[model samples]
Target: MSLRDRLFGRERRSAQTARKRLQLVLIHDRAGLSPGTLDALKDDLVAAISRHVDIDASGVHVTLRSDRDKQRLVADIPLAPSRERRRELG
Candidate 1:
């Protein structure tokens, strides 16, 4: 790592991902949910949504957001472009 990377923490993407995962685990534990529960939920959501719409499953994100006194589940699902849209862009 260069001095700039060291100074700016630019090479910490994997560390950041790990930290986020740990935070999710802590949140899940506090919420009385098993660590695997969120993964299962994400899978279920992808399946249900895929039945009705084309989605980029790989890009789907399902996470729990915790604020001061509230916690909320957030899902960011990316939809695939329709054939017409793809053709237009092409």
Candidate 2:
């Protein structure tokens, strides 16, 4: 860490992360969904998607986004490469 970083408490990255989490909480509250409900929704999404395709469940991200007057549910699901694709890449 540089002297400037230490003096400025450059740990702002962690603070930003916390702020994002707080924003998510607010969004969920506004949308009338609890955190547990969100988790259950994510699990259901994983199960439904996994039935048809391979996915990296651990890396899946499901969140709510507020845009103008709309609250949108966004899901970023990472797909695992198929065996043929893996072999080709390897």
Candidate 3:
């Protein structure tokens, strides 16, 4: 390889590394949730839902989602459908 190509490659690597680090920091700042806290939250949410109905804990999905300027926590909690729900339109 040429000297110019090697220098360009180093620059690209540095840029990618910096972007990744920035994203990690920004995620924590925006959500105010540390890694440990998120884990505990997931556990608590699952327990709460399990108390009321039958759910597949393994299928539970929780994550932080962001709009252009707004951030929200989204959880998809799946529950078993009852026969009554199938018959009712209201």
TM-score of each: 0.70, 0.73, 0.61
Q: Per-residue lDDT for 1-90 in model 2, tens only?
A: 678997998756677889998987889999998878989999999999999999999999988889988999899999998999999999
User: Who wins the TM-score comparison?
Assistant: 2
Off by over 4 Å in 2: 1-22
Cα RMSD, model 1: 4.7
lDDT of 1 by residue, 2-65 (tens): 8999899878767788998898787777776674888899999999999999999999998877
- Indicate the residue-level lDDT of 53 in model 1: 96
Task: Tell me the deviation in Å of residue 55 in model 2.
Answer: 0.4
lDDT for position 43 in model 1: 97
**Which of candidates 2 and 3 is the stronger one according to lDDT?**
2
- Candidate with top lDDT is 2
Residue 46 in model 1: shift from native, Å? 0.3
Q: Give the TM-score of candidate 3.
A: 0.61
In model 3, which range of ten residues has the least summed lDDT? 7-16
Could you give candidate 3's per-residue lDDT for residues 1-90 as a string of tens digits?
568978777455667889987876677678998767877898899999889887778878777766788877878888766668857944
lDDT for 37 (candidate 3): 81
